[model samples]
Target: MGTKWITFDLDETIMQNPFGKWVFPEIVNMLKKEADTEEDILDLIVSEHLQRMSEERFLEAYDWDDIITDVAEKLGAVSAIDIERMVIKHSEPPKIYLLEDNMLDYLEQIKEKGFHLAAATNGYSKYQLPVLQKLGLDKVFDEVITSDSAGFAKPNPAVLKKLSDEGEIAAHVGDRIDHDVLLANRLGILSVFVHRSLPAEVLSLPVDKRAEQPSCIRLCEEKWHKENRLREVPFMENECIPKVVVQSIGELAESIDFIIK
Candidate 1:
């Protein structure tokens, strides 16, 4: 029998940076002087990064230097010294927190079921590897595939195809619909959406009620568009839909059994 593989996205799936990704106050103050508004700083940073990413064909994993350089050039006011400071601050390693308290135990259970596991993430290996080591996840995953290592990011089937070559992929679990679900669906693997941070109740609420909540608005505007860069891409029903949805990693083992059966 072929090896049965279960692939997972690292960030916000099994683990996450508890502090979350945020612009430093000092950097914000520096950019504010050149930016039209406080929001413009963030807007320009994202736009410039995406523009550069398109130029590179999204194959290479960009670092802080690349983003800071592009943003600084676009602003046309920030000094190289200030830009260097921003890069230094942003380049610092994040403190990782495993979402599930018994995450490793659950993973071991899954492994005992004869399923080989993999972490297929968009993060660069330099960043992702350390997090895995800190969380002791380095010992659990059979394969750790990162954008830098794989030469492609999520939503691109090539990233997952590398693992598919080694075994029959039973399922791919992740927190993002656009990236994780889309990629798995494209490759005909069962997509499992794990809502680690957001619960189903928030999602089930009426659109109007959901709009009243800050989390829902952030999810809709920031996560859906800003982080994933899905604004330009045309939405397809099959691409964003997952075969199975679970609220936590604790629920994943049962879902995996149902999928393979």
Candidate 2:
């Protein structure tokens, strides 16, 4: 495949965050130590922080460390040390479900074929980077782009603009239609959506191509003698809808190989 570049998503695409179970519990425990009323603390501090972010709001808000401090102060008795410890504990990662069957092997295959690769996610860069390293896949990416750094999240054309600015990217693969497929489609990059969590019937709407998983995409090469039904699905949305849907990153490679050829 003569494809120049490929981009990917992080959470649910590469890994899973057990934060709902582990991280939340840790936060609750720390809150217990504070001398303030839990009611007021949860409402004022936590709620305000969770509100939607605008450029102005983001600039006005506390940085990551300061956010921790605000939460601790709300408890009236929590310590910075405790907050730090909790963060460190929860940070133990890869947080991804590294499915056993030679996952990295497929990525290496694409790399060997000379395609540039990147990751564009809505997550924060500071936290997302550590998870990639834990999976030992950090070195695979030529670039790691995140919403925090990009100043805009997915479905935003500006983020796609960043991808184009870096180089000529051929495809963008991700799990969500709204953020990944739609946005990629709008940006003129071939969009490939992996239906790992969603069923095929549910996505029966027109897509350039479809597959069960990343590995299965190899069928494009495996059955070279057979006519490949590959589709050059373009981005789509207000003109941004993704044209292709696959099951895994491996399949994304296969589709790309077929498209580029």
Candidate 3:
């Protein structure tokens, strides 16, 4: 496959969470004073997040403000929203933009080789586009396809195919094996898996043990679509053992070269 275009996953593939650096640390520190321990607060938060991830209702859109405030109120801790507002008001604080390590140079390197770059991700366009702007990577990708535009998320062929032109050879690079690799395998396109966040811990467990409740997700989505439904969408049923896995974005570039040849 002589790949003409390479599409990438946004979060943790080449983009990270912007607020985690300052916002979360402050919340944690605040919680630590009131909670039994830092670890306990952390565990609470993680548990809530995992619960949300497993719940089909809250799976798609993450409400961080709600999560922080609710967690704060529950734990009898200082309001994270208040602390965040104060932090923003008081001083000219440091701003940390989200981008994966070595992502820029690698993208540039590929572009120099005349490869068309794009992004196909499972997110709302409103939120995801701003993230790309903040990272100054808005222009890096030739095109960006989101769930909003695609009418569905990855593992559904439509999202990736949104970045394609007729007869164009393409490869998708992402961290999630099920979302990215399995989707590519199904479409018979080149798949490159980047090991970033979300360790494949979900994979080691049996289907019943996994966190993703796809049936619930589909039901919720179906309801959502029915009220605002356009057409039918697919669901995540099974996982295929991924064939192309890499440790970093830099490695992805190498893999792209190897696969294309």
Query: Which candidate number maximizes TM-score?
Result: 1
Q: Tens-digit lDDT track for model 3 on 84-160?
A: 35334322223434455567888887777778888887765655665676566777888888866777767678766
**lDDT, ranked from best to worst:** 1, 3, 2
TM-score of each: 0.72, 0.67, 0.58
- Per-residue lDDT of model 1, residues 164-252, tens digit only: 78779988888887678778889898877776456466656532243345554444344445545633654455566566666677777
lDDT of each: 0.68, 0.59, 0.59
lDDT of 2 by residue, 39-146 (tens): 654444444444423222432232344555666675675455443344345656443445435657777777777787788887766556656776767888878887
Ranking under TM-score, best-scoring first? 1, 2, 3
Q: List the residue pairs that clash in candidate 3.
A: 225-229
Per lDDT, the best of the predicted structures is 1
RMSD of model 1 against the true structure: 6.5
